[model samples]
Target: MLTILVTGATGNVGQEVIRLLLNQNCQVRAAVRNPDTATEILSVHPTAGFSDHSIDRVPFNFTNPATFATAFQGVDKLFLVRPPNLANVRKQIAPALEAAKRAGVKQVVFLSILGADRNPILPHSKIESYINRLGIPATFLRASFFMQNLNTTHKEEIKTRGELVLPAGHGRTSFIDVRDIAAVAVRTLMEDGHSHKAYTLTGGEALTYYEVADIFTAVLGKPIHYTNLSVWNFIKQMRDRGLPMDFITVMVGIYTTARLGLASHVTPDVEQLLARPPLTVRQYVEDYRQFWL
Candidate 1:
């Protein structure tokens, strides 16, 4: 069995990727930060029908370099997720890449943002380029904005205020499902012909926030609205809400990028690779009903 280590295994994408890998009866490892996440995964793993796989649940913190070796031990494949914390996040990625290289891991799938490999304005794009130039065999899944983000965090605002507000004006984004992203990641980790390739995965439609709101209202049978605030106003709102400067900066940059139409367009890869059509916004709204409840 191929030994695979899934870092950030407790995350939205990580959990799904780990589940998909385990379903194949592969030797699966979950690298989590706490025993609670491990315990939760263990309880659900068998019920999810993955108890037969080699379940190596290990603790690995991005800030702690000493634990890297132990988690990398006997590992042949890797699925890397960026830690949620932005402080020293870049500093941590290179070392982890080095450790993966040292461990002789065959292929690494990075959950990178769309346009990260090409957008010169965003720092993540530079990091993605640097990783591409490295000696190791790596694949960057430059995924679009996850639809799940809106479900959890943005949904609160939408439900309370009846509006979806952002800085992008008349610009569209190919908001994708994290579930689809996980499926692609698992396929890349398990299959061949994916190395040296950067896949730009997206939902089937490119939609502006207004159009997105309309879609939600149509699907969910409720009134939803879109407020296109100026970038400064958006920053002020976030800052007034006590968001960190780093987060505010990145979010402003993302909106700026979107205003320039960076995130627009649909890709055929999702349907081609998965042998199914990517979920529609209607489906996303249905999924959000569960999230809201």
Candidate 2:
């Protein structure tokens, strides 16, 4: 069995990856900060039905170098997620990639953003460069905006105010589901012939926030509006929500990308890799309707 070490194991994508890997009967090592807590979370995961003994949870933290070797041990491949809070790629992520190299991790699937390769200003680009510099065999999954962000980040606003707030004015984004991203990641990790390549993953359709709000309305039977704020106002709103400056900065960059009409490209990589069409926003809203209700 191939042993795959999954960082960010408790995250949305990580949990789904674990679920799929377990179904494939692959040995999964989940690197988490708290094994016991991870055990609790994974135990109740609806799709991840593995018993506690099936997974090996190793304590790992990007900010703490001491935990890297133990997590990488005996792992043939790696699925890497860059925590949104860790903005400094050089300081927070480089050492762990170096340690993975030392531990002989043969392949890596890195979760990156859609424009990271072209936008050197983003931290994901810097991390990609470092992975190349380390000479680690890797596949970059440059995923587009996740549909789950509606429930995770903007849920409060939508549920409370019945509106989507962002600085993406009249810009369409080809939003994808995290589940699809996870599926693609698992395939790259398990199969051969997917090394040193970058795939831009996105949903099949590009839709503006106005269209997204219509989908929500159709699903939930409630009025949801897209409040297009100015960039400064959006920053103020995020600051008022008590988000850290680093996270706010990343969001600003992402929205700015959208506003410039750069994130609107739809791609067929997800369907090609998974042999199924990517999930649509209407489907996402219908499935997650309770979040807005």
Candidate 3:
């Protein structure tokens, strides 16, 4: 029974990872900020389909060095994800990696963004460098933009304002589903021949925000529009919504990168990993149609 410690266990990706791992009867320790709340949430998660006893919950905080040792104990592999709110990798993630190293953790499968190595401006690029500096047996899952963002970050506006507003001007993105990314993470954690490898995960196709809006309209049977705003207006809207400046900056940067056509690259990695076609944007929109409605 190889034990894998999962950071950010309650997040979108982590929860899916834990669910998929448990379906395979793999031992998973969910490292969360609050074990009790996490346990409750997992038990009730619509897709989790597991009880509290199905997975282990341990207190782990990226900012707290003390919890890392305890969470990493007896863990053979680690599933690492940087919390979206935290930008300072040196102060937040470095300590945890040190603790994992000290705990003698064997391998790390990190969730990194696409083009992290080339984009030094992104924090994930710095974290990737740090992982390399540690010389740990690591695999980087460089995933494209998540399709779940439709259900999360942009959900409210879609539901209330009937529009998708962003700075991505006619830019297409390879929107991969988080579930597919989780499946790849589980395979890398459990299988062999993946160490020291970097896998770029993306959907089968690239679609622009306008195309996504059309999908939403088709699926929800209503008129949904894509409001392409200027980068300045996007920043102002996010700030007015009380989002942190760092998060807003990162969001805008990624959108700008997409607008420049850097994010439109589609890959076969997801299909190659799963031996099946990746989910399409239309399918994703149809699956979550109720949310948009």
- Could you give the C-alpha RMSD of every candidate to the true structure, in order shown? 2.8, 1.2, 1.1
Candidate 3 off by > 4 Å: none
Report the poorest 10 consecutive residues by lDDT, candidate 1.
Answer: 45-54
The model with the greater TM-score, 1 or 3, is: 3
Q: Which ten residues in a row have the lowest lDDT in candidate 2?
A: 42-51
Deviation of model 1 at 26, angstroms: 1.0
Ranking of models by lDDT: 2, 3, 1
Query: Against the true structure, candidate 1 has what lDDT?
Result: 0.78
TM-score each candidate: 0.89, 0.97, 0.97
Error (Å) of candidate 2 at residue 2 is: 1.0
Model 1 TM-score?
0.89
Give the better candidate number (2 or 3) by lDDT: 2
Runs of candidate 2 exceeding 4 Å displacement: 46-50
Per-residue CA lDDT of model 1 for 207-262, tens digit only, reads 88889889878876788888899988998988888888788887777677677898
**Native-to-model Cα distance after best TM-score fit, residue 170 in candidate 2, in Å:** 0.3
Top candidate, metric lDDT: 2
Model 2, 220-254: lDDT tens digits are: 88899999999999999899989998888888888
